[model samples]
Target: MHLHYLGHLPPDDPLDGYLRFDIAPQLGVHRTPSGFRVFQFDFCRDVYLYEELGGAFRVVGKFFPPGRRMAPGLVRPPTETEFQNLTYLHRLGLNNGSFRITRPLGYNPWLHCVLVVDHFDGQPLGEVIHQAIRQDRRNRLFRKLSALAEFLAVLHNRTAGDWTVDFSHPYDYNGRLIESLVEKRGMARSEAEEFYHLRENWRARTCMWEDRRVLVHGDATPSNFKVGPGREVMVFDLERMAWADRVFDLGRLAGELKHFFLQETGDPWAAEPFIGHFLWEYCGYFPDRRDAFRSITRRIPYYLGITLLRIARNAWVDWNYRRRLLEEAKQNLRAIP
Candidate 1:
């Protein structure tokens, strides 16, 4: 879980009132939406209390980079729209959901640099599931799983094709997006030819495109969500929202549901009984597509298997927090039929 920090390096967005440096803000004079302000609102969540006051909020404030303890290096400032888009994407959620990953609270169009979404809230589904299992209360497990399914259904229903990003070569990977997925996740590394052939072989696993496509929230991990006071699942942060494979999106949900179910039961084989029930419940919203849905179902093992492998690969990079993860990864692998 490396949060993308592309916002800190580039042209600073004067519109967003962002300044670049490793300087931690002090309770001092910094302009706000109003006027000169001594401090900003206080944030109390995720084990940290951050109040902006009396200083410039640098791009690299109170954070250490990956390999270095000193701090991230200085960089060129951000441009106008570049900065604004970052803020808009981040704060845009405020208008729609309870949270936004905007670069800065304030806007400064003059400097282009903006912030990345490092914000993680909402009890990670994993943590939430773990606590429930520890307390021997898996009653709401199905309900929560259904809730997540609904969220995915909505997102998959809206995946658009027009929207594009800079890095991705859309011209190259349109229909073959699954191939890209295979390569990106390192799931089909048997050989280059084998991976290519496998990718070419995977047909559109689902007929989710029968109705329409809007926007697919690319990443829907539990950590990306946050539960409001009443446990309302407010889906926020559309950083990866885009036109994408409908099966890919739903496949992810199936994999997650399988992981949680197997975790609670500790038996990979026990997953099948509930899986049919879950799929039935999931399709209640996006009805009349059992064939497409089941295609994704059968492939859940591939997705889940690759996902577990990725965890192992990530663990080798850093051993400090491997125990809890290693066990889960192995369990996921075992549960993958």
Candidate 2:
């Protein structure tokens, strides 16, 4: 293999050997690579590897930050969890069809916990949203949102399981975010307390537990999904994937749409039509679409509120914007439906 570095390769990096010796066999590339290039995407964290010959292979390697553990004494690393999640979903038939995901190639714990997967050539959905807002491409945005809605609906419906929907996870998650706002972001304790009580009210709603658990993307932000030229949706970032209420994904997506519109156009209501369309499209995948729509809409507000609070925790967001998010979240939480 005539390996070339287009970006910095860390000292004593073993990635070349890992790809040549471990990943090559799985890819059926018995022949030596005539030429190869590696480009670091995010400093030392992500790299794009390309083989000019030997079938012109291309893959992205993601390196998990060291010292991060799922829990005390848990040997399972984030790399393993993500690889297993990807493999699990792939086996469930998400590797092809209209809805897809980056195919997991391999993972090397020795090489900085690098998880390798097929490199997707698609535009990030976030960028698409930006284009839609800036260029007034409402039709294009509608089509993409429909595709995403279908993708998520299929994922949740196919992965529905016997496990019960646990409200505790979301309750704790929201509480923690509020606490962080008060403790770290200088949010008033009274405001945080009010949010906490509102969250508690949501927890008491029996509608929250009506649905069976399904595998949710966990992080359904626009940046985590990509839209191909054919408008196919491919979701990634499965590190947060878990069994939860299906709306966990939908509401986060809705929250993102609302946030983008508010930030870009200074109109929160601008996203309402699209959000309605997205959720309505999602309901189409169910046997009783109307019932599904009614049930999901009833529960989506809580998750949307949670997503808003989650975004508010980000330090990069302007303090005023964060406060607005908190207020929006409060209104959603206060909804009786």
Candidate 3:
């Protein structure tokens, strides 16, 4: 097979509408990429829900990036290399130790595997950010994060796997991940420094532990959880759930707090209080990993930079991809403490 350039599409250009011609294996269903508000349910799992598909039927789809396929829509949802990382909560019967994540709700003008998840209503972490912004209160954020850490602690106790059995943190160490990014990603020198520090701070290798483990949601982020009625907090995506370091799960959440939620309102300080609550709420029981929390929190800026680079690098395929990424890099550095 010869390598052919799909060419670059600018960030503003519609990623779903790119031209796919003959001489290539066609990807999944065809559809416009924009419009729906998307968020995550697990590692490499996401859902874009349309409240009303323009008066037709409500539409939603679970996206899998690493495996490269959409749940029930076009064979491939557009944008195979989506910008952000997919976090917790997977569709029913995936890897979460169950066969029923959702019930086939019914049909829509769009696709199949229509899931009618019973009691499938909950506010994702992203939505909570809006609420946090509204009331000028960090309580909800702290509460939610607290629930998440507690949940992880229990999951850690319940899940039992052996690193001697199985392991799955794609990047096991700081140096390994950094070298790959620098080589394959061609990362800038400055960005490399941040990535290096973030990786080291987390003691990245600890995230690779597979043994002496308990069932974990592997990737715990706001987007992966929902606050249901009655203050019921339910987790959705479990694609990356594993019996591993508690820090891995919380680290993911802490890192996200800096990037999407806190930064959006330009209130980095908003993360200040929650950090303590998160660690205090979680580490009380899992005393083994308390230092890990402190490390993760302190390294959030570096992690944010790493995340921005991931976004910037992919966007580089499009015009100004490099320039835009460089700008983000500069901005990211300035945000550092």
Q: Please report the candidate that would top lDDT against the real structure.
A: 2
The candidate maximizing TM-score is 2
Q: All models: lDDT? A: 0.40, 0.82, 0.46
Per-residue CA lDDT of candidate 1, range 18-133, in tens?
A: 33221122223333422112211122111112223332332212212233332133232222223343454444343244332333333332222222222334455556556655
The count of backbone overlaps in candidate 2 is: 0
- Residue pairs with colliding backbones in model 2 are none
**Listing every candidate in turn, what is its Cα RMSD in Å to the true structure after a full C-alpha superposition?**
9.7, 3.5, 12.1
Worst 10 residues of 3 by lDDT: 16-25
Ranking by TM-score: 2, 3, 1
TM-score of 2: 0.91
lDDT of 2: 0.82
Which structure is stronger by lDDT: 1 or 2?
A: 2
Q: After superposition, how far is residue 122 of candidate 2 from its true place, in Å?
A: 0.6
Candidate 1, residue 308: the lDDT equals: 34
Model 3 agreement with the true structure over 1-337: per-residue lDDT tens digits: 0122233334353322221121011222244332322233333333544322222233334433354445442343332211111212232123233112322222222322222222245566678866777766567777777666666655565454554323334234334545655776676677777655645444444433333645556456666677644335665544444445445565556656654544456555565566567767776665557775554444344434444444444522443444444454345434433
Q: For each candidate, give its TM-score against the true structure.
A: 0.51, 0.91, 0.51
